[model samples]
Target: METAEKPNHIGRKIGRIRELRGMKQETLAEELGISQQAISKIEQSEKIEEEKLEKIAKVLGVTKEGIENFSDEAIFNIIGNTVTNHDNSSLLCFQPNFNPIEKLVQVYEENKKLYERLLKVEQEKIAYLEKLMKEK
Candidate 1:
């Protein structure tokens, strides 16, 4: 006699994805415009409404189908197989073919431009406020 396997729980799968993505229940609740307790309840439920599930999936940076089909074991197996050394040890090290200092300088330049734009906006706001004060 064969026994039937239990069906996967959609809520549990969604909870796992949210955990893996480093999101707190409160954060998800804020994004969904619901309470943290509601998020906790949703995580404990076996099934969720399709519309709510789609919203959660979008906030978690995954599709509804992706959430439904996700498996932690499959992810672990893929990473384990992909990073095995000749001795079957799993000490994976990545070396990028670019200068680290150059990348840092590029990022710094971009931040500087943004800061300049923000400063300009603040100055404009201050000028407008001063103009209003003079008129009054």
Candidate 2:
């Protein structure tokens, strides 16, 4: 019989916990004294040595066992507990479900529309000023 493929628990759990703590990969990398590229590799489920795993667990404030064994359900429970302990202030601030790049595009489109409208308003103001000057 073929052996079942092991789940990518380390990457998935790390990603879940990091997002729950509102930490970026670069920030975590800096805290652990590792390069962001290394963090990226970890998040992407690349093989990590035992020493690196220990460092990551220390930086994330999780136990080495927790890093090694967390399932998706366990990670979700941890995230839920974290949210419950905090004030509801971030209820509105949390855009955890949205993709960052998509949000950026949305803001850009909104600003572009606002800029076009403002340009039209400015042109009208200039026209009114010219008419007033000619009348004077």
TM-score of every prediction relative to native? 0.61, 0.49
Per-residue lDDT of 1-136 in model 2, one digit per residue for the tens? Answer: 9999876667777877787778999999999888899788888884567887888888888887877776767757978887764666866777677799999999999999999999999999999999999999
Report the lDDT of model 1 for residue 32: 95
The global C-alpha lDDT for each of the candidates, from Candidate 1 onward, is 0.91, 0.83
Instruction: Give RMSD to native, each candidate.
Output: 12.0, 11.0
Error of 1 at 124 (Å): 50
TM-score for candidate 1, please give it: 0.61
Clashing pairs in 1: none
Off by over 4 Å in 1: 1-3, 86-136
Error of 2 at 124 (Å): 31
Candidate 1 lDDT over residue span 14-127, tens digit each: 889999999999999999999999999999888999999999999999999998888888889999898756763433555679998999999999999999999999999999
| Error at 87, model 2, angstroms | 18
RMSD (CA, Å), candidate 1 to true, equals 12.0
Assess the local accuracy of residue 97 in candidate 1 as a C-alpha lDDT between 0 and 100.
90
